[model samples]
Target: MNIFKYINEAWESLLSNKMRTILTMLGIIIGVASVISMLALGEGASDSITNSIESMGTNTIYVFRDSSVTNSKTLTLSDT
Candidate 1:
């Protein structure tokens, strides 16, 4: 009923089944470790992609022309 009594009972229960206690702790440790590792991996991948995009200069632009347009002419140097 009191704090110390509750703590004592909880400790006793844990100690009563040694194998179960160990297995439960192992599962919790493994779950936490896996979650942390996955987060680190995702952060690393995000940073890599960000660095790649930044390295390619911000002023880069892409142009697309439809070849199927009958009268469309390709721009030449003098057309600029």
Candidate 2:
């Protein structure tokens, strides 16, 4: 059988299971929506942070260590 024929056959099979197809499409829609929203929020947050950092000063060096290391350093507001 040709590729077109096989594709048509598969499409017909999928159509026959309308409920399953709808559920699958719904799943894809939810997944894509979640990903898009997350990406947009993340980008917006990053842009905001970059703006804030740039406005602060070019000499600032932001460093982050693990929780345990921070505890050992006796970190406080004075470090900032």
**TM-score top scorer:** 1
RMSD vs true structure, all candidates: 3.4, 7.6
Candidate number with greatest lDDT = 1
lDDT of 1 by residue, 12-79 (tens): 99999999999999999999999999999999999999999999888986568987889987777698
Each model's total of backbone clashes = 0, 0
How many clashing pairs does model 1 include? 0
| Lowest lDDT 10-residue stretch of candidate 1 | 60-69
* Pairs of residues clashing in candidate 1: none
- Regions more than 4 Å wrong, model 2: 58-80
lDDT of 2 by residue, 1-80 (tens): 89999999999999999999999999999999999999999999999999987898978866677765534665588886
Error of 1 at 70 (Å): 16
Cα deviation of 76, candidate 1, in Å: 7.0
